[model samples]
Target: MVSLGYPEERFEDVLEERRCNSDLLFSARRFAPPTYKHRCPRSPAALRRAVLDSPRLQQAIREMAGEDGDTEALRQEAQSILREMGHNQGMTVVRTFAFMLSRIFKALFRHVRVNEEGVQRVQKVVQECPIVLLPSHRSYIDFLLMSFLCYSYDLPLPVIAAGMDFQGMRLVGEMLQASGAFYMRRSFSNNPFYWAVFSEYVQAIVRNGDAPLEFFLEGTRSRSNKSLSPKLGLLSIVMEPLLRAQVFDALLVPVSISYERILEENLYARELVGVPKPKESTSGLLKAHRILQNDYGSVFVYFHPPMSLKSFISGRLDITPFSMTPRHMALRLSDTLRVLVHHLAHSVVLRQQHGMVVTPWSLLTTLLLQAPSDHLFPTSCNSEGGVHLPDLLHDVRCLRTVITKIGAMQDWPDAQSHEAVVLSTLAMNSSLVTLTKEGRVLLNVDKVDRPKCRDDILNRACTVLTCAAYRNHILHLFVRPAFVAMAQRHAGSVEDGPTFSHFCFLVQLFSEEFIFEPGSERKDYEEGLSLLQRCSSLLYPLDSQHHPSTITTNFSVFLGQIFQPFCCSYQMVCNYLLTLEHGSMQKESQLLASLQEFALQQLLEGRSTELEILAINVYKNAVASLSRLGALRRERRKDGVWFLTTSQLHHVADAVASLKPPSQLPAKL
Candidate 1:
């Protein structure tokens, strides 16, 4: 049996249960597709010819020639661009690579578990309609995993939309192209010819239904490891053909992939702190291959139910043009596409969140992050001492119960399973965590006695940040409970506590710090209340403002601890913004540099944890949030300079700083 990267006894029941009862269509030969030689129609060469000979494209080209000065040279330029952007969907090559990659990846990881039912559902959808596989973006392996899953299921492979970043990798790029990945320029809005060819090429694929299309709606990997607000660039282009009735419709499948350990966790965290990321290149790929000898835990892939565009637009008002015979009908949809794009983008995020898989690493990270900094490691093996194993187990049970009640524990495990998972995870990550001879878990932080090199020091520093990245994967699931605990801790007693409205205000205020989904304030409030009721009898919302509730000794340190670092970091960003010149514009790069310098100083002085508090990406995102809140503005010319929009910088700073959790939170203003 292949390693599933999980303890067999713990996972056996769940996997077998799922396999037996799965109602997925065509389940007989679903997970294992019969392997055979086949050729995909509509090859890259055929797609290019169709695009060039397209009447709509020719008209668009002609219009460009007259209005934008396009000539025979420009026409040839368009053809060349098409050739450059197109991909060859060679089934034999895809199959060969898929088989080889499965072996290579299995050797690299402990387990790779795909939701067999999910794959079956995707296959069923593809048989009925065109599919758009919209997966979350966090690592480069995202598209590779999607393609491999489809190939393994014997379903048609997707024509993946890849960024131009990979196009520079000569042999690798060509191999990717041959394996059904198409290249797209980062920016091609100014080049009408490029746009024409690219649009037509995409339309040809969707219109033909030769294969399903796949791309990350987030556009690029998120350094913070959160689902970024979706980028609508490719989505808009892909939807154009369906909107114009050139194709029947497409099914958008939102896929969420969870890694027991991320390959780029430390690198992503480093990039967040303003460390320059090495460019993706063939040489870099080769260099990274050495790490395959090490074990990465498990990989989980979950596919949400497919959403049809036709059903989505069923009750909505038609943004389509009234003129059915208008020239460039397909391109006309692009003008008013933002509304549709925004809807789909938001849907993708919610679906991705819903489909997220929770593994032992995620659960363990959550527990460790929430524990008191000192108690994170057991001091001794004695039962009456620090971080008792039973206490930890109880806490995990409570967490699993509450989160499951709140609909966030899709993959929650039973006690035996949970224990197995914890033990297995600690064993796998012994360098970062360990089980004492008495079975007490302790974080491994004490340095080795031997002399260390510079690289070793850097690796040790990255350990915390990589752990933070793992913690972030399940962070959103704990938001409501965190908010409730923060509120309870902030209030001295129920009599002097905040009102429900005030708590809601704080949730909105600190939205960006935790990447709260838009318009979820009320839902968060209700869930927080549910958690508070379960965790403590001392805290309860008052029926009237006149009769305030009471607070007790019972409270969750987990809520406050998990959010403190993020809250403190956000306050630091706001404080730095106040130091900027009033009403004066400053380049964002300059602002980030100043923030990084200040953070470095704080780190040197032992006043800050650099990973959580000093990351430049966090500050950059904070500024963007402030801009959304009308606290700042950006220049039009794309110089990345932000203008201080309000004169009340001090007031804004104070407001944000007040939302910090109680342990680190200051007295209420």
Candidate 2:
């Protein structure tokens, strides 16, 4: 809801409005309420054409390619190809390769083991009835991993509905088709009909055993590094068909995927912090291809127990489209995703927290590299080493405990070496900058992670800002503005460009001083102030009177450390900010403010210590739940920001008021 130039995509309010549209609700005379029973979709090919002509398809194409991008013609052609190439046999082959590749990467990374729990449930259900594999969506690799795991274990291959934007070359499209993937326009949630077509197609797949379907119930990659709202557009569409044929028995398998040290996570994190958005250019895709080629991460999938809707159709259990429709499916999906997130944060991601109680290596590496300005790690953690930094090893003890809790999971390898590998991978950086010939004691950090001191605490705080706790605290009273009313309508790209990258580069540039080699006379505090000064350009001040103890020095000292000639950077950001005098930069300042508000609240709330907060996935899971609820209603703020659906207005108002316990939620029944 900050004035930053980004789309105010309020999902909840939209869902509410769409649901309560009195006109549509009363349209029975025109199209008639759907009949209770479904038949084989009439000439399904005709339905495909209707889908091609849907408004959503036209709108999504216009979003990226402009009004004259041959939207209609392309849709028609796409559908023609889909119809002609409908059922594919190679789903098995692609799935096999995908699983083999994933397993290969896991071994190469020496990651925690992948133990498929609830294996019998998945197999038994698949044997009894058709299934829809609704997994929590994570990365691009999610598609292949799910398919491979299914077929490799003797289950039939699953058809995935992937974004058309990712289809790439014709061959890739063909490959996906053969792998049982159907293309969907990336931004088609708004247009009703295409969703209808896509829904029906999935319905067809499930109604018959043409292909069991796979879905990332959460719509997209979790921005907060957890699950996202399960976009219900498809779910709504599939309902009528299921209701009609009373094939109410189809099972929904909840799949969860966890990763250890995802390569693209840093890129996603960068985008979150305010980089210029990148376009889908050839170079970008090529970059994605290169990352995929590395295959440097682990993939773990757990199949939660399946839920069948058959009992409801037989008049045994009550079903409200919202509450019980996919209750079991959603819960298990949410829980599994949450576990995956925590596993990565505590056991894999390389960073430090207050009271982290880690091994000497983790503490040493963090302390040496953590100096805000100094690129190097201090030579040793002693007064004799110069600069009396805090006792890092003691500080990190709590962090180690979180890791231990993470490792306690059933899927974690029951071996210590694997644990070490998982931790090392989290700390790995492609580039090495060493100040010492022996590369010991202190000096330059792993080149890759130096992109920014990036304030590890701040990053976690920002990611958690989506939490109900933060939303209730910071965003509750500050309502969003309407899209059309926004000061600068539409969003600006923050995924690319020198604007933000320069900031990261400066963080990295200053990190060099952390290791300052043995003889360098730079004090740790001095190095910090310098780095702070260089980094401050990327930040702005707020409520000067309420400055937290975390910042214990005067502004001038900070300035000196940043601008000194030895500082690494094209130039310090603080200098640039003061020079530009862009007063409106406060909008660019929200994440930090958001983080400050969140961190302070968490401290006051006494829920979890900082390291425990960093390691937990609860924040992300709550955000996903609320986001899903938010998307189903309509509401807007005075500043043109979209808010929770008016119906869910109370939910936000309540959550904003306090971080209520799960028991605080009202009874659904």
Task: Tell me, by TM-score, which candidate is best.
Answer: 1
Residue 63's C-alpha lDDT in candidate 1?
A: 79
Query: lDDT of all predictions, in order shown?
Result: 0.65, 0.38
Clashing pairs in 1: 4-111, 5-111, 494-549
lDDT of 1 at 259: 73
User: What is the per-residue lDDT of model 2 for residues 162-265, given as tens digits with 9 covering 90 to 100?
Assistant: 76655555455566666677777766656544544455456556665445677665556554333333455555444444544436566666665554434455
Instruction: Give candidate 2 misplaced runs (Cα > 4 Å).
Output: 1-113, 276-297, 311-669
TM-score of 1: 0.82
* Top candidate (lDDT): 1
Query: How does model 2 fare in lDDT?
Result: 0.38
607-667, model 1: which lDDT tens digit per residue? 6543467566677767776776667777755554555556666676776777655543211
Give residue 375's lDDT in candidate 2 (0 to 100): 21
**Candidate RMSDs in order:** 7.3, 20.3
What's model 1's lDDT at 471? 72
